[model samples]
Target: MKALVTGATGFIGSHLVEELVGQGYYVTCLVRGDSDLKWIENYPVKKILGDCLKHEILHKLTDEFDYVFHLAGLTKAANTNDFYSTNATGTENLIKNVIKYNKNVKRFVYISSLAVGGPSMDGVPLCPCSPPNPVSEYGRSKLQGEEAVIRQSDEIPVTIIRPPAVYGPRDRDFYMLFKMVKRGYLPYWGKSFYSFIYVEDLARGIANSVKTEKTIGKTYYLTDTETYSNEFLTDTIASELKCKYIKLRIPKSAIPFIANIIQKLTKTSIINSDKMTELKHTHWTCNCEDAVNDFSFKPEVTLREGIKWTANWYRLHKWL
Candidate 1:
């Protein structure tokens, strides 16, 4: 078996590549010229350096693989156009090229996000069956990408996996929480709840989807079974760090103004008004029942265990 993984240098993609190699599949990583290759430096795999949107590069690479895992995407950007171009249009280009050349490719797995469902939908479980009501440009673009794959379902074996807040060792998105816990300072914003899956668990789920014949033309939400509220998550992190928790709740109305000021002062896109808006209003929980039933996808790590592992990684690498 052979697999081609796009975004093979990213946090989730690198883990997927490792899992595929362990499963005895010859893995070929499709990476950009400037992408960081540090994560897979020790792994033995073929590396193809080119843009996913380019037909010449994808034409050559797509023909040689039995499976294509499309994980390359832009999560957050300054504008909507960039998001659409990279996530939506780039996905369309890849799928088109694959259909034209790689007719024998067994599977094409698309890694999407729970963001496509927006912050919350009343009485909806945010399942694959739920209609997408994306609020942000990131979410909208991802939905568009998924649509592109679904449209080409007749030509390829397509599967979509929407993972919620994946975290583990070397994940930078949740590093701030680890840092806050280490420093003994953490904040609880609102009545928000979140779901997370360990990166390894998500990778396993993706790998299984490729192997499982029933996964074709189906979409699955890969997440931990339980959801964690802000208070519970902060407390767990504090306990792991052996630190005291200080709970602070800022008014939702004031977040946008404060976020604007902070963005102006920092001159970086770290904490902007849009992110504050998302943080204030979003309750990111999902239903993973379909994934569980179809792929036997049960998350192996609990929140506490995963947090401890993440904190340890930070300490080991001097990132904390």
Candidate 2:
């Protein structure tokens, strides 16, 4: 089997590429020439330089691959339209080209975000059937991407995989918390129930979606069996790091100011006013009972084990 993967250099996408190669699929990765390649540089997979938003670039590819994994999308943007342009329109472009050119493609797996479905109500885990109420611009854009995939259901055998906050080796987001804890400060925002999945387990579930027949034209939420709060996660990471840290709880009202200060200092804003909407939401837990029953998806790494491995990786790489 052959597979084409976008976002191949990203934290989750790189892991997915590794899993695909290990499963004996000849893989071709679509990435921008400027993308950081350190993550998958050791892998012996074909690489194509292209941008999903540019139809001309995507149009150049031949439909020789048996599977297409669309994982590329803008997660952070300075404005709402940028997110839609990249995440939603980009997905539409890819799906359109796949349907137009790839005749033998068996599956087009879209790796979506739990943000697309928004926070669950009353601490309940969101199922796929739950009504979406995306609060952030990024979430709205991701929901657009999902709708784009669903629009092609008649022509392409697509499966959508929505994963919650995913963290593991090579992850930059969650690693920030680890760094903070190491520096003797554990920071958290508003109270919220969050869901998490280790990167490896999410990759496995994604691969299973490709091989599983029942997942066609269906959506699956892949997450660990536990639901936790921000404090719990912070505390767990501190425990895994074996560090002492002062608890810093930034109130919801102050997130916008903090976001501005960070953006100004870094000259880049991964978090902004739009992100505050999600931070203030009370729940982000999702139910994965369908993934468990249909794809036999079981998350093997608990939060403690995953955190330990991630912290160790950061230390070894001198990122701490």
Consecutive 10-residue window with the lowest summed lDDT within model 2: 263-272
How displaced is residue 229 in candidate 1, in Å?
0.3
lDDT of 1 by residue, 137-246 (tens): 67888999999999999988999999988899878868877776667665555677887899999998899987788899999998888878877877887788788856
Question: Whole-model lDDT, candidate 1?
Answer: 0.83
As a whole number from 0 to 100, the lDDT of residue 319 in candidate 2 is 91
- Badly placed stretches (over 4 Å) of model 1 are 261-270
Q: Kindly list the per-residue Cα lDDT of model 2 for residues 1-320, writing each as its tens digit.
A: 98999999999999999999999999999999799998888998999989998888987567788999999987776656889998999999999998888856899999989998898867889999898889888999999999999999899799999999999999878877788888998656666788899999999889988777889998889999899988788888888878889878788788888887776675435556776678888889999999988888889999888888988898899998
Top lDDT: which candidate number?
2
Q: What is the lDDT of residue 245 in candidate 1?
A: 55
Model 2, residue 230: C-alpha shift (Å)? 1.5
What would the TM-score be for candidate 1 when compared with the true structure? 0.94
